[model samples]
Target: MARVKRNPMRGGNKFKLGVFGANADGCLSITRHPDRWMADWDDVLAAAQMSDRAGLDFFLPLARWKGFGGETNARHISYETFTFAAALSGLTEQIALFATVHTLIVPPVYAAKALVTLDHASHGRAGLNMVCGWNQPEFDMFGLTKPDQVYDQGREWFEILRRTLAGDAAFDFKGEFFDLKGVEGAPGPVQQPHPVTLSAAFSPPGRDFAAGSCDCIFTTFTTYDDAKVTIADFQSRVDKAGRQAGIFAPVHVVCRPTEQEARDYYQDYAVTRTDDAAVDQHMAMKKNMSGSHDPAAYDLYRKRFAGGAGSYPLIGTPEQIAEEMIGLNNLGFGGLAMSFVNPKYELPWFLDRLLPLLEKAGLRI
Candidate 1:
């Protein structure tokens, strides 16, 4: 087997773009009003096909064991992550498929097998987004006793995952949470050792783990200053760990033909949620997990609704959004994980208008 050469200019060259898809039930925005709804199976498959044709790099479908927001209708209560990816792999030809795997909730060996299976299904176009389980209710649904146990379990899970995905036929891993003896994955991922691994971590331990293990780190911040500081902190940690930071940023977007149109659409789609109960529930979850009733984050959230910009700030005219994307590219981010307002309508608009601009800007194919 040949060694996989790391792209030294991967982060600085151009923006590798991707889209976030609906996993099980449908693709619904947590913050936005549940106005647009795509059919569970056909619409999602079509969306994947559209993204592939649009020269998108990857499509990430978030996994949730149970609903988080108060709105129970759009919450995914259908197929599992691996299953959804498998179906998408059959439907789409080029774009990579990423499934969200909660490390703390899932056994590492199981997760590894699932990813390997998806890689085989996709024929080398599979990835994993490793998430440290944050939802307390989801843990309870799994019969877990305490939320604090999640971090320790996640550490152990990653240990097993790193070793097992190496495809070593005889690997021994003994940890506090998981113990395996000479286990190896069959039909190892076509992407060398395994598929691409990603994470979204803001805390110190999370950042350290991402720097050491993940192929990309998914992050979100309200302002450019906040984003710069966050990226700098992560890069510092990566440097201290003697590892290269591959890519870092969130995977959401809002692009339009004009800046006013983009802002109007952003506010109309995201900020106009009529279901206050769902928003409150989401806020409560955020508070409990991170103690971040930080008025700043909320203010930023409001700004996103008000056409200002939010955590994943890629709003403006095509040229302006492209410039922001270039800024991210310069900041050692290898990819943009993007999502649209209403994928059925907005995706085609993006492909027709914004993508051409991005290509001219040397950020896309």
Candidate 2:
């Protein structure tokens, strides 16, 4: 067993920060701009190394099986997440490496074994972001149907993975979605019990799954006041289950030296050069298949969808962005997962400008 490093996700930073979706072209932005992220291997590796050195907490990759049909055909190419994490494990230290997995597609036993391998490879800096399968087109690519009882299947899938990762004696398990006998794996994860598990949940069943099974839950919000209500509700569920959890939000940021520059850039990429067809396909599918956002967001936030996959917007100067973050922290959000137009080129600037304000505001040390 390798020496286990302290998990940065659970570190003392009052508001944890991470880079999201660098594995996919254009990331969360549905843009056709020439400067859009190409997501080549070299650039991806550079982004991860940059984030690790910048003291960002984690690097979360997207799991996309196919691209949304459009001019750019966003996310058509992506690295398999488990392998991606394993590859990065040896190259970086400090930052957590998270692999996004769809429960229905990847068997629990295989996922468990692979995660332990990642844990060993990373010497304990591995995390899992469990996503109940969404995107019917992606499922169609596998010739599989998205089940109505998806969360139920996810529950059983997690249970099997959990037990297998425990490295206990072999056990038999049967559930509505899966049936397995003599399931067990070797070399448990470096993080005691298991590595940190997260779920991006928005619907009631999804939220319940996160409350019951995850170390943290990711959700989208329209407004702070609305988010407060949702957070309270989710936290209450966690409390009732006699578990502790953190609530996180995802954001797309465009920070600049001046507010005008930030807004201008956001307008340029998200609206002016936005991939209209891509946005249409992405939003229509999301609205129909996933409950990842507020209902109103579908109509009101097309620009936001192009900006960062319908994540909360953080477009402003460092001070303004920091103020919004501080407000989020005050509103009980544990942290944020952020996306940029091109993390390899933009992340350094974001950190150089934002980290000091966050530290000064006591959000980070």
Which regions of candidate 2 deviate over 4 angstroms?
1-4
lDDT of each: 0.66, 0.90
lDDT of 1 at 222: 58
Q: Cα RMSD (Å) between model 1 and the true structure?
A: 4.0
User: How well does candidate 2 score on lDDT at residue 47?
Assistant: 92
Poorest stretch of ten by lDDT in candidate 2: 1-10
Highest lDDT, which number? 2
In order of appearance, the predictions have TM-scores of 0.87, 0.98
**Per-residue lDDT of 1-365 in model 2, one digit per residue for the tens?**
33435889878898999999988988889898787998898899999999998888999998898887788898797889999999988888789999999997899999999999998889889999998958887888788898997899999999999999897799999889888999879988889899988998898899899999999998899888889999999998899889999998899999888999999999999999998998999999898999998899989989999999999999998889999999999999989999999998788888998999899889999
